[model samples]
Target: MSTATVNPAGGTSPAPAADACCTPSQGEAILNAGQAEALALRFKALGDPNRLRILSIVSASESAETCVCDLPEPLGLKQPTVSHHLKILVEAGILHREKRGVWAYYSVVPGALESLGASLAAKP
Candidate 1:
């Protein structure tokens, strides 16, 4: 995908495609070699089904976050196992963590998700 830098301050530079609209709010920061690796690592973490389910369940709650005890029984996994998935998500920058005593909370990182979407939508 082609990368075009967008200023985070204000205003949007045109994307490579002339007809493209919905310019990103944060000016495009084209992913370089290193940035691409970082992004790929994030996607790799998401390739797991368990991780995806945890994220979905957490996202479905009234709060944008989830606690260790909140997962459903259908996952059929222990808390430590579930927390392992959460750790990968957290490392991937796709999740935000809140520690309340021994209860660790997790939430989606919208900017990372949006950036991933934008990169995919960009020209190849």
Candidate 2:
């Protein structure tokens, strides 16, 4: 009752059993749809070069926060454009926005980067 096939070389080999060939690998847990969508939004926010630069500038500021006013000159971008990038970062939960007087200050959200990295880490 062997399930074997003849090869072109005139050799008879046992074909792979259906169950063995179709078995799924036991891998680590994967992200759910909601988690995937949220992480995708965060990654999408960081995908732009200008947005990444804005994050670096804000995170590297001496006061641990940066005013939107100061970002335009350093990035060589217009004020409105800088503000737009900041808005996306904030919406992605990667940055925090605070209003002081008429100015908006931006800072990296605590542990946000670490959380994003951990989501992609392999479980042991």
Candidate 3:
């Protein structure tokens, strides 16, 4: 598995430092078009207010994880809609999902949630 590390936020993310010769070794290169697009897509998914709220809630959850059934009451959305958003988050790599019998669980993917912060710090 590719390890994604949750970095503490610095004043400026690495994206702004694309040409930075002083780039930290922790920063990974977006060496190809595929990587750039993938990172952009992840950011786009998080661009939504609802998804952002969901991420915040899930991130702050006691277990750092939650199930679909547990989300609606706090989010004030129907389960189906919540599930749809969850799917988008999962696809975008911001959230991790797993099946436990009939229900599905979601959790933030460590560094995955913070990729945008890194991208923003880059030169691009």
Candidate 4:
């Protein structure tokens, strides 16, 4: 993949291509290195089946949030395993975690998933 920097003053400029042979005239990437890295991390976190299911469960909650203790049964995983998945999702900014007494409740971050989807869409 080729990388480029967006000129803050106005526009974009190509930096260097990781592989010139595969590089196209597409010009610059809409995302910078840091942005690409962060996005990649989010995608990586979602690459797991368990993480996808965990996200689905939390998002499907009618109250828009679910307690950590509530995840195990539907997920068919132990509480500790579910918690581990939750931790990764939280770190990826895909979910928000709140502690109330001993239970941790999680909710999807407002526009995080939407933003990720938009990022993947072709831009005109």
Top TM-score model? 2
Query: What C-alpha RMSD separates each model from the true structure?
Result: 11.4, 7.4, 14.0, 8.5
Candidate that scores best on lDDT: 4
Error of 4 at 74 (Å): 1.6
lDDT of 2 by residue, 14-87 (tens): 45455434423335477678878877899899899999898888888737679988989989999989888988
What's the ranking of the predictions by lDDT, best on top? 4, 2, 3, 1
Candidate 3 local lDDT, 15-119, one digit each (tens): 434444454565455467887787778878888888888888888884756888888998889988998899899898888998889878788888874566876
Tens digits of per-residue lDDT, candidate 1, 1-124, equal 4544554565455464544455444645566798778778988987989888887787787365688787646588987798788889889888899998988788887787778778778832
TM-scores of all predicted structures: 0.66, 0.72, 0.66, 0.71
* Candidate 2, superposed: residue stretches over 4 Å from native: 1-29
The CA lDDT at 63 in model 4 is: 74
The true-versus-predicted C-alpha distance at residue 56 of model 3, in Å, is 0.9
What lDDT score goes with residue 119 in model 1? 72
lDDT of 4 by residue, 37-121 (tens): 9778999999999899988888898475799888899788998899898889989998998998988889999999988899789
**Ten-residue stretch with the least lDDT total in model 3:** 11-20
